[model samples]
Target: MELHEYVRLDGVGLAELIRTRQVTPPEVESVAREALKIADERLNGLTRPSFPNALDAAGDGPFAGVPFLLKDVPIAAGVPFTLGSRAIPDIAAAHDTELMTRFRRAGLVALGITTMCELGLSFATESARYGPTRNPYDPARGVGGSSGGAAALVAAGAVPLAHANDGAGSIRVPASCCGLVGLKPGRGRIPCGPDTGEAAFGLLYEFAVTRSVRDAAHLLDAVHGPAAGDKYLVAPPLRPYAEELDAPHPRLRIALTTDAWSGVPVDPEVAAATARTGRLLERLGHTVEVATPALDWEDVLAGIRGEVVAGVAPLLSAPRQPPPEALEAVSRAAMSEVRAFTALDLLRTFDAHNRVSRAVGTFFADYDLLVTPTLGQLPAPHGTLDYDNPRYSVDSWLRRLFAYGPFTAVFNISGQPAVSLPLGRSASGLPIGVQVVAGSGREDQLIRIAAALEPDFATAADRQGTLDQ
Candidate 1:
C-alpha cells in the first residue's frame, strides 16, 4: 500500500480492503507507520511514535487491520498516560480502560498516543510539557485541543480514526479546526470505567474524530455500551447506529443559532458557515429556524469550574503531588483557588448544573435538533490561549476558553449528543465546523443528519491536498 492510497481511504474503506485480501494487515500497518512518522514531523501531534510496540487487532471486526491512535488522556495498558501535563510523571497504565478494551475488540491497531493541553485546561494544544500541536491545514494556526493532536494527524491523513474524548468541547473544537467529523456521544452512551465511574460528573464524553460520518457511526457501534460499574447508562439504540445512515428520519425541527452564549461576537466566516448549514438542512427537508436554547452562560461556566476544582483539588492536595513549580501558572492558580471552595460553593455549582440541564431539556422537547457554529472564531494563532501566562486565575481562564468556543460546552452541561462537521471553509481555506446537536441518547438522529449533510463538503483527501499545496 502506498502513502497516497493509505491516506485516501477511511477506516471502513481500509477494512474492506483487508477483508477482501486486497492488502494484508502487515502491508497496511507498514504504510500506516510510514504515514505516522511523516505526519509527526509535519504536524507535531503524536507524543511518541509507539510504532515498534503497536498492538494489533485480536480478531476480525469492522475496523480489523485499520491503524488507529489513542489520545493521551485515556488509559491504555502498558502505554504512557501523561494527560499532557508536567505536574504528573509520565507512567504506563497497569491495565486497559474499558473503552480501550472495546477498541481492541473492534480490531483497531493501536499506533500511539498524541498530544494535548496540560491538564486539558485550555482549548489550544500548546502545553509546556510537550510544546504545541500545529494544524496541518496551516501550521501557523492552532489545532484546537486537548484533542488537537488526534485531530491534526487525522486531518493530515495519518490515520483514518483516532481516539478523542470531550470535556467542554475538547473533541469537537479540534475536529472543527482540523476539518474532521467530531462526535461527542451523549453522556453514558460510552463508558469510562475500570478506573473512574464518570469523568467530570458526566460533563465529559469519550469518543473519536473521524473523516466520515459512517466511520464515526461504526466506531460508536463498536464501543457504545456500559461497563460493569458505570454510574450512568442510557437505553441502547433501536438498531445499530450504522443502520441509521440509510434510515429515513421524519422531517426534523431544528433550531439554528449563530449567537454565542458567552456574548463573544462570532467570526463572520464561522457564522456564515453555520447559516449555510441551516439552509442545507432546510433543503434536506428539515425545518430550520433561528432559535436557541435558553441558557445561563454564567451558570454553565460555574458548573464547569466546580467540576475542574473538585477534580484537581484532591490531586494537588496529595502528599506526593508535583512541586508547585511543575505546573503551569494557570494550573497553580487553580490549585490555590480551589482551596477556598467550601461545601456551599459545590452545592451552588450543582444547582446551576441542574437548572441548565433542565432548561435545555425543555427546549429539546420542542425542537429535535439545534445547529450552531462549533466555535466562536477560526483557529487561533499559537499562544492565543496561553496557559503559561500568569495573568489568568481559574475563573478568568475558563471564561476565555468558553468565549472562544462559546457554543460547545452548553451541550456538555446538558449531557446531550453533539457533532461538529467540517461543512464550510474560509476564503483563506481554514476549515469551519457547523455543530448539530440532538437530544440525550439520540446519537442515531445525529448520525442520520450528519450523513445527510456530509456530502456538502469536500472529501478529506481533497482537503489534505489543499493543505499540501
Candidate 2:
C-alpha cells in the first residue's frame, strides 16, 4: 500500500488487510514511516519516532502490520518516556507497562511517542519541553492535550489510531480539537499498572483516540481488563465492544445542555455545533430534550483540584530535586497552591466527590445519555495555555482550563463513561466533537448512541485534506 492509502485506512481495516496477507507488515511500516515524515514537518506531534520497533513488529497478530503511537506519559518498554517536560529527559522504559504489553500482544507496532503537557496539568497541547502540536485543519490553532499529540497524528492521517488517556479532557479535548473519536472508558476499563493503583480520585481512565468509532471499539476489546491488584474494575460489557457497534440500541432519551457549567459564554460556533448534533440524534430516532442537571460548578471544580493536589503531593514531597527546566510554571504553581490544603480540606474534597457522584448518578437514572459540546469553543491558538506566562494565578489558570473543557470533568468525577464524537465542524472548518456521557459502567449505551448518530453530521470525506501542506 502507498503511504496515502495506508493513512486513509482505519486500524481495523489495516489489521484485516494484514491478517489476510493482502498487505505485508513491512509494507505497512514503510507507509507509516512516510506518513510520519509528513506529520513531523507539519503537526509537531511526535517527541520521538520508533521506526526500528515498527520494522521489527511487522508480521508479528491480528494487527501485526499495523503501526501505532503511544502518548508520551505512559511507560512503554524500550520507548522514550518524556512526560512532555524537559524535567524528564529521553529515558527509555526498562519494561512494558500492562497497557503496552497488551498492545504488543495485540500485534501493534510502536512507531513513536506523541507530545503532551508537562505532567498533564493543562488543557492545551503546548509543551515547553517540545514546543506545540498544531491542529491539522488549521495549523495556527491548538490540538487539545495532554493527548494532543496523539489526536493530531490520527486526525491528520499520520496514523489510524494512537494511545491516549483522559485525566481531565486529555483524550476527548484533542479529539474535539482535531476531528476524531475519543472514548474515555469507565473506571478500570483499561488497567494502568500494579504499582500505580487507581488514578487521582478514580477519575482518570486510559483509552485511545481514533479516526473511526469501530477502531476505538476494537482497540478497547484488545486492551480492556483489570491487571491483578487494581483498586476496582468496571462491569464488563454485555457483548464485545466491536460486536456492539452493529447491534442497534433502543431509542434513547438524550438530554442536551448548552449552558456552560461555569456560566461563561460558549463560542457561538460551539453552541451551533451542539445544536446541530442534537438535531442529528433526533433524526436517528432518539428523543432529545434540552435540560440542565442540577450541578454545583464551584464544588465540582474544588473537588477536582483537591484530588489532583492530594494525589500528586507525595510525588511533590519526594527528596529528589527536579531539573530547573524540567518543571513548567503551571506544574510548579500547582504544586505550590496544593500545599495549602490541610488533611481536613482533602476530606472535604472526598465528601464533595461522593456527593457529586451520587447526584450525577441520579440524573443518569432518568436519562440515557447527556450530550454537550466537549469544549466551550473551537480550538484555541497554540501557546495560549502555555505555562510561560507567570502573571496568571493558579486559580485563574484553572478557570481558564475549565472553560476550555467544562463537560468532561463531571464524568471523571462521577466515574462514568463518556465519548467525544466528531459529529460537527466549526464555522472556520475545525472539527467540533459532541460529548456523549452515560452512567457509570454504561459505556455500551454511549457507544450505541454515537454509532447511531455518526453518519448524520459529517462523512469520511470531511476528514481528508492537506493536513501537512
Candidate 3:
C-alpha cells in the first residue's frame, strides 16, 4: 500500500495488516517519517523523531509493524524529553518508563516525541520554546495542550495513535480540539512508576489520544495494572477493556450540564454541540437529563489547582534549576506561587481534596455518568492564552486556563474514569467533544458508552477530511 494509504489505518488495522504480512513495521515507520516531514511544516507537532528504534522493532507483536508517537512531557526510553520548554533542553531517557515498557511489550514502536506546553502548566499548545502546534482542521487555531502535539499528529494523519498524559485537561482538551478519542483513566488504571508514585493530588493519569475508541481500549488493556509497588490501584475491570467495547451499556441516567463549571461564559457554539450530544445519546436509547449536580464548582477547581501547584513544587526546586530565560513566564510564575504555600497550606489542600472527591463520588451514585463539553469553547487561536505573560497574575492566568477547559479537571480530582468522544463540532468546523465520566473504578461503563456513541457520532472525515487523503 502507498505510504499515505498505510498511514490512514487505525492502530488496530495497521497491526492486523502487519501480522498478516501485508505491511512491514519498517514501512509504516518510513511512511510516518515522511508524513511528519510534511505535516510538521504546518502543524509543529513533533519535538523529536525516533525513527531508528521504531524501525528496529518493526515485525516484533500485534502492533509489531505499527508506528506511534510519545508526548514530550513523559519519558519514553531513548526518546528525547523536552517538556516543550527551553528550560529543559532535550535529554534522552536512559531507560524506558514503565509505560514505555508496556508499549514495547504490546509491539508498539515509538517513532517520535510530540510537543507540549512548558512544564505542562497550561492548556494551550503554543510553547514559547517550541512554537505552536496548530489544529489540523485549521492552521490558525490551537490544538489544546499539554498533549497538543500528540492530538495534532493523530488528527492530521501523521500517525494513527500517539501517547498523551493528562494532569488537568491535557489529553481530553486536545482530543476535543483536534477530533479524537482521549481517555484519562482513573488514578492507578495505568501506572506511572519507577520515577514517581502518583501525580498532583493523584489527579494526573496516563493514556493515549487516538483516532478510535477501540485503539484507546487496546492501549489501556496493555498498560493497566499496578507496577510492583503503587500508591493505590483502581478497581480492575471485570474483563479486558477491549471486550467492554462490544458490551451493551445498560440504559443509563446521564446528567447533562451546559453550565460552565468555572462561571465563565461558554461559547454558544460549544453549548450547542453539548446539547446536540445529549440529544444524540437520547436517541441511542439512553436517558439524558439537563440538571446541575449539587456541588460547589469553584471549590472543586480551587482544590485541584492547589494540589497541582504543590505536587509539582518539588520538581521546580531541583538543585540544578533551569536558567530563568529557558522557562516560560507562566511556569516561572506558577513555581513562585508554589513557593508561597506554607506546609500547613498543603495540608489544608489535602483536606479540600477529600471533600471534592467525596462530592463527585456521591454525585455519581445517583447518575451513572455525567456529560459535559470537554472544553468551554471551540479551539482558540495560537498564543491567545499566554503561558509566558509576566504581566498576568497567577489567579488571572489560571482563570483564563480554566475558562478554556473546565470540565476535565473535575474527574481528575475525583479519580474517576472519563473520556472525550468526538461527537460534535463547532460551526467554524473545529471538533467539539462530549465528556463521558463514570464513578471511581468504572472504566468499563465509560468504554461501553463511548463505543455505543462512536458510531452514532460524526467521524473525523465529517469534520476534517479523509485520513487516507
Candidate 4:
C-alpha cells in the first residue's frame, strides 16, 4: 500500500488489514516509516527516530503491526528518552516502564520518540533541545505541550494514533489545536509504575490522540489495567472501552459554561463553538444547562503550583545534570525557586486540592457532565510563549499559560475524565475543541458522549479541510 493509503487508516483499520493478510506487518511498517519521514520534514516533531530497530520485537498480539510513537517522557528501552531537556545526556532507556511494556504487548510497532517541553514544564513546545513542535493545522501556530510533538505527528498523519499523557491539559490542549480526539483519563485509570509512581500524585494519565473516538476507546482497551504493585489503582471499567462506543448513552444532564475558571475571557470563537455544541446535544435528547462548579481559583492555582514544583525534585536525582549552558535559562532559574518551597507548601497544596475535588464532585452530583471550551483562546502563534525568553518570570509565564488553557486543568485538578472534541473553527481556519468532562471513574460515560459528539466536530473540521482524509 502507498504511504498516503496507510496514513489515512486509523489504528483499527490498519489492524483489520493486517489481520486479513491484505498487508504484512512489515509492509504496513514500511509505509508508516515513509509517512514518518515525510511528516518529520514538514512538522519537525520527532526527537528520536528509531525505525531501524523499532519493530524488531513487536510480537503477535491484538493490534499486531500498528505503528506508534511515544512522547519522550515515558521510559522506552533502546529509544532515546530525552524529555526535551538539554540538561540530560542523550541516552537510551535501560528498560521499558510498565506502561511501555503494555503498549508492546498490544502489538504496537514503535516508530520513534516525539519531542516535549523541558521536563514538560511549559505550555508551548518551544523546546530548547528539539526546537519547536508546530501545529499540524497551520505550521505557524503552536502545538500545545508537553505532549505537543506526539499530537503533531498524529494530527499530520505520521502515525494513526500515538501515545500521550496529561498532567495539566497536555493531551487535550494539543488535541484541541490539531483537531483530534484527546481523552485525558481519570488519574490511576491506567497504570504508571515500575519506574516512577503516579505523576504529580495521580494527576497524570496515559492515553493516545486519535482521529476518531472509537480509536481512542480501542487503544484504552489495549492498555488500561493496573500494574502489579501500583501505588494507586482506579476501579476497572465494566467492560472494554470499545464496547461502550455502540452502547446507547442515556439522556444526560450536561452543564454548559463558556466561562474560564481562571477569570479569563474565553475567545469568542471558542465560546460560539461550545454554544453550538450545547445546541447539538440538546437536539440529540440530552439536557444541557448553563452551570459550573463554584471553584476557588486561588486554591486551584496553589495546588497546581505545588504539585508541579514538588514533582521536579525527584527527577533531578537520576542521571547527571548538565552544566548551566546545557539547560534553558528559564528552567535553570525555576529549579532553584521550586526547590526552596517548603514541605508545608506541599501539604497546603494537598489540602487545597482536596477542597476543589469535593466541590467538583458535589457539582457533578446534580449534573452528569460539564461542557466547556477546551482552550480559553484559539491556537497561538508559534513563538508566543517561548520558555527560553528571559523577560517573563515564572509567575507571569504561568498566568499567561493558565489564561490560554483555563478550562482543561480544572478537571485535571479534580481528577475527572475529560475529552476534547474538535467541534468548531475560527474564521481564519483554526480548530476549536469542546471539552466534555465527566465525574471520576466515568470515562465510559465520557466516551459514549464523545462518540456522539465526535461526528459533529469531525464535520466542522472537514468543512475547513482540517479533517480531510
Clashing pairs in 1: none
Residue pairs clashing in model 4 are none
Report, for every candidate in turn, its global Cα lDDT versus the true structure. Answer: 0.88, 0.80, 0.80, 0.82
Point out the worst 10-residue segment of candidate 4 by lDDT: 459-468
Show model 4 residue runs off by greater than 4 Å: 56-58, 459-469
Residue pairs in clash, model 3: 25-65, 50-111
User: Candidate 4 overall Cα lDDT vs. reference?
Assistant: 0.82
TM-score attained by model 3? 0.95
Which residue segments of model 3 deviate by more than 4 Å?
55-60, 463-468
Q: Write the per-residue lDDT of candidate 4 for residues 182-222, one digit (tens) a residue.
A: 99988778887787676776677788888778888888888
What is the Å distance of residue 297 in model 1 from its true position?
1.3
lDDT of 1 by residue, 1-469 (tens): 8887888889999999999999999899898888888888888898876558667566588899999999886468777777788878877788888998899999999988899888777789988888889898788899998899999989988899999988889999999999999999998999988778778777888999999999999999999988887899899999999998988869999999999877889999999999999989999898989898888888998889987875687676666886779889988898888888898998899998999999999999999999999999999999998889899988899888888999888888889999999999998989999999999889999999999888897685558432233
Model 1 superposed RMSD (Cα): 1.4
Please give, for residues 152-259, the per-residue lDDT of candidate 3 as tens digits: 988888888988999888899999998899999988888887787876758788889999888988878887998988998766788998999898767888899988
Candidate 3: worst-modelled 10 consecutive residues by lDDT: 49-58
TM-score of each: 0.97, 0.95, 0.95, 0.95
- Cα displacement (Å) at residue 353, model 2: 1.2
Residue 107 of model 1 has an lDDT of: 95
